[model samples]
Target: MLLGRHPCWRQNPAFPAIKASTFRLRRLPSSNPSLRFAAGDREPRSFAAEEMGKPKQYWLLKTEPGEWSWDDQVASDGGVAEWDGVKNKQAQKNLKSMRLRDLCLFYHSGAKARRVVGVVEVARQWYEEGDGGHGGGGDGAVDVRVVGEMRRHVELAELKGDGALKGFALLRQPRLSVVPVAADVWERICELGGGYEGDGGDADDGDGEG
Candidate 1:
């Protein structure tokens, strides 16, 4: 099936619009800083899980900002977009396991920015997105919406320094794009981030990017 256009968005321009150009889905962006998400607003992951009687899950998603930055995600279509492009077998397995309300940490991979900058939730469960005209099978994908951002970005160095996170999946499986996050570890990271896990939800905290 042809997937929606995934915006190959950027940040140096500051909140550029994300409109799907091809089978890859892109998101819509807003330049307004006043735009706020009330949790109840937009796509709620729990609604689907609640109706289907499925439990929530946690995970971490890593992406190189050169393709799309945190600002691109936040600005993308009211914080919602399809998280496509997983070709790795291991990572695709992780994506398939995601259920509604499954929370994920948005990790900015690559040398310049290696940190957890925000949190997103599964808006749509895993679905087969046939090659969008690409010769490859195109693997699979899922829809994710911005739930919130880390007011205080969590650095990879900090995560490595903390003895408590020794067994973190991201640490053990650095190459995996979709790594699961344990509940306790999730709390630990949030606590370490000054106890403000949902920074994007608060209008006063627009410092997630940078």
Candidate 2:
């Protein structure tokens, strides 16, 4: 089922709106041994993000596993695929705001599937996309590539129950297909998904399967 057909996403004002992300990264601790910025050493890869003067952003995009499962996403040509079928106004804005390299949580929604199963990177920004017959009629869409599966999946109940995530966008706007994810919330979820191992380096988003 395309996101447009997902029953839970039908437009309704019952849910509260989540604030848009308007912040950017200012500094990264140089004390971490993993990131050596000492005198003569070459800069680490993450330095570019800091140089750009824009804080990295995170998002959560919900999809039904039966319609677009993790396997399907990982196998998409070049490990990337078009993310369409969002009609919610706020969700459309979220898609448009995405920038290259932005990270997103791939969430599965439905009967027994409300969980964050993996991570993906924004490979392309939003563009004009026609309704591919799914009836989303959304403002636009973006392209995402599989980052990797989480070491552990995070369930909706867990997120809702965690007092730290009381301001989480997912819980606040349950009906939106695409929602912004606060960095802290992103880190917390990553921790719950089995440590903060998103780079796939010491963990899995790297060249190896998670």
Please state the error at residue 64 of candidate 2 in Å: 0.9
Candidate number with greatest TM-score: 2
| Candidate 2 stretches greater than 4 Å from native | 1-51, 133-139, 195-210
* Poorest stretch of ten by lDDT in candidate 1: 1-10
What is the lDDT of every predicted structure here? 0.78, 0.82
For candidate 2, write residues 32-139 as lDDT tens digits: 777764663654557455549788899999998988888889888987988988877889899999989999999999897999999999998899967662224555
TM-score of each: 0.66, 0.68
Best by lDDT: 2
lDDT of 1 by residue, 1-210 (tens): 222233433424454554456335456466654665666356657654565755567899988898767788888888887787887888889999998778998889999999998888898899877764111345677888887778689999999999999899999989998898998899888767754445434566566765
lDDT of 1 at 11: 28
Clashing pairs in 1: 4-25, 5-24, 5-25, 5-26, 6-24, 6-25, 6-26, 7-26, 18-27, 28-77
Model 2 weakest 10-residue run by lDDT: 15-24
The alpha-carbon lDDT assigned to residue 131 of candidate 2 equals: 69
Whole-model lDDT, candidate 2? 0.82
